[model samples]
Target: MRRTMTRLGTDTIRRLPKVLLHDHLDGGVRPATLLDLAAQAGYQGLPETDPERLRAWFTAPTSGDVVRTQEGHLARFTPVLDLLQTAPALSRVATECVQDLAEDGVVYAEVKVAPEQHTREGLTREQVVDAVLEGVRVGTAKARLFGRRIDVRLLLTAMRQAADSLEIADLAVRYRHDGVVGFDIAGPEAGYPPTRHISACEYIKRENFNLTLHAGEGFGLSSIWEAIQWCGADRLGQAVRIGDDIAVADDGSAKLGQLAAYVRDKRIPLELCPTSSVSTGAVRDISEHPVDVLRRLRFRVTVNTDNRLLDGTSMTGEFTRLVEAFDYGLDTLRWFTVNAMKSAFIGHDERLELIDGVIKPGYAGLSTEHVGAAFFRMEDSW
Candidate 1:
């Protein structure tokens, strides 16, 4: 029997309840808000003053070095990070981040931020955390007003090249009862291995806190090895290169090497960012991403929008592309959502509540004109 094509539309995918585990707060500031904040702070570093042009300027490169590909992706966040130095700016950014995610049908999300990067404007690290958390509070409250309910938390990041991992880890533990849920190390992963931040990882483990490491984006399998085996990471951020450890013979039989086998055997969650992977040159294109192979192999994989502004993508966009590329339907999308919820840093009961209560039933709504959302109203679903 021939296989029936399982196609999903962007409209339907947009309405499905999403659980996002990887998102950078600073990389997703609203354009209009950025302009308003610039005026309030008297900052003049914007490449384009107009909101539309400024939004384009972030991911567009008209000049020699401003390209938007892997080479120019990191440059897009320079001005954003600089603009987010003050407490108010951080809070507003966090608030809008939640609002946007909620609007995109994301019911649960953990937005990551590096507090050390935002301290240049005389705000203490604690103040930075406080401001972001405050914004999360306001954002959640505002989402309800719009008939959208979103739960957002923060994951404090430490620069892998810096000596502040221990400090950041301790800070995350300090706010465990608050909105902060986990600690992470992110930077250039080639020269700065995860082993370098052993103290922080150990500290988080000892404190019984959550830990995820950024690895295998611009590097190779060794970086992933160190992240999983050395640092004891609970999840692998941008672990696109873990696919390299799998080898295929001429007859099309695939084999997993020791490291890859270990990763798959352990069911370590991989926070795969397809669009950002292409933007960062981790993979040439979304169709070429390892997510398909990894999924077929039953690897613990989840989808994420790494930097919404830089990639000009969202959780919905990511799912749309995956559906288009792989011809996936509701089952495939649900798998990714459940993987994210299970891998989330929140407590087991909370995760189960969302997985069983919101995500599954929301997706079960009859497919109507609006991609499975017509039968279930936002207010009614909750």
Candidate 2:
């Protein structure tokens, strides 16, 4: 067992073997890649052509406020999506996505892509899936040459407002053996509830496939309730609004509402992206983010970069924010990493291999002080 009193620094956090469960492929296109694709495809919708300015443009708020409506934030993906219409463009984006995650020290990632959005170019849904999978394969091979071990998988997402969820669900199942791992429903969670895709969810469940829903971000607890109870979501994406169901008394004691209690008790994973949550108005800012409360209460909390380009965030940045806000050290960081590994949509043996083999050892090797009994006790339990 390793006990450390030193806080997790940027370099250490970057080197940690992190697992991501709720990242979006369309929302994470590199600014340079977007510019190149736009040029190649003859699409000219980008606000800025210069790489630095374009990066700033994507990350900057729409109305000079850091917080925006979920719909407003989502609209920023239009340029990226426009360029990703062709198979080659899709492959390039997917390859670059994996390379970026690998460079950021992601050990395993399940990236979500909506096939329906890429069909305007006349590519069939199967062709779209195959292109992305090819990119994943190419990216993985390239990463291995550089000694970066990143295992990437796909999650096929259906737009909640659309009626093509069952189609998307079938596609996800069809490609389960060829890099696709799970199913998800994304987009405007308010009016288009998860129940709108209940048939898709049921099909996934009946097929024993994994499902994660974008709940409690754009909407409130009802959305989360439907996603979990009605739709049988395996994970909740940015479930920050769950804090609404919790109360803390003046004495500093806490009480959980029924939904929150059930969520915590079941060890349901909350894929909380702190910066993205702020951008989407899920919380006012990182300081008020519910991840700290959920983590303290022992809910299965995992930090993620919901969108690297849109949020201008990475796994390193996410952990750095948490460390600054909550004073979290290596132990806390290790706990979060381990929690994500345990909750991933991978096989049990593979999950255990990453935890015991990669994550724990990586954290144990970091430079730190010989913190005594308290740290050792935590290590024993872990």
Candidate 3:
């Protein structure tokens, strides 16, 4: 088993099978799409006049620092929200988002976006839901036509600082068959707790809808605890701050706090967005990411691009960052990719089909290409 695990082919990792459990539809808009949609909608608040400039603005460094700095912090989440205020605009962005993810080598992606944020143009919650679904349907069909297969699932989020979470939950359940997979709460995570939307959480639970809450990112373990124990979240988004509850002993051993032990033992899925986490200051750096510790400890760690445009990343980039930071070889990459596929918010049979039909075969084909020494080196202490 060890030899088989250690000898993962470079080609397999290069093909880099991936499943994204936590990307935001509004947050993942292609700059070109946003530009065209803004023009069609007669809105003129775009940061740049042209798509190339907008793309550069999205990916370029802010405040003069190239690597890590505070110059680009505000540009991360606010730009997407700024441009995605109208329903038609949101729909166009969401549709192109799938195309973008597919081009970036994501086989399956679940994009989360709050419907409430796009209603500035008098769009009802139902209208918002339908429009986003239409976009995903079109995008997925286009992907299949181009021989790049991917299943896009929409997860409706209720802004944490806002009311009417139950309304959003109802919208999610109503569109279950129309590409909507689950319900979530997203927004400023510091002050507005998940308990603020208890009714929505309750509705999701009663309706058997999937739930993933954004917790333990900027906040601490208390936020994570409430999302799981108080709200019954099936998965967690950016649950990086749970590292605070973990302790490393003097003799190279580790001890998990009560919350950490429960979360690890129960195998709760953590949708970790490495670049996004760093941009948001959720962790000190990529190398210090708790994902390595969590993965080695047998936790259900899933890789995601929380916001592609904001973080200037795709699934491939996130995987490459992990590989570089943790010395993760093909085995670890495959493990993480498969873990993401299993944790997707889809039915058992559908996920099985994707894994067997596309993911496994893709990796096997890549495995025959490269027989390198190793791509990354794992820490002995780890």
lDDT of 3 by residue, 159-272 (tens): 888988999999899989888899999877778889999889989999999999999886788999999999999999989988889887787578999999998888788999
Best by TM-score: 2
Cα lDDT of model 1 by residue, 12-71, tens digit: 778889999999998888889888988888888887889888878766643575333443
In model 2, the clashing pairs are none
Ranking by lDDT: 2, 1, 3
Flag the better candidate by TM-score, 1 or 2: 2
Model 2 Cα shift for residue 148 (angstroms): 0.8
Clashes of each: 1, 0, 0
Model 3 worst lDDT run, 10 consecutive residues: 373-382
Per-residue accuracy of model 2 over 135-176 as CA lDDT, tens digit each: 999999999999999999999999988999999999999999
lDDT, residue 111, model 2: 96
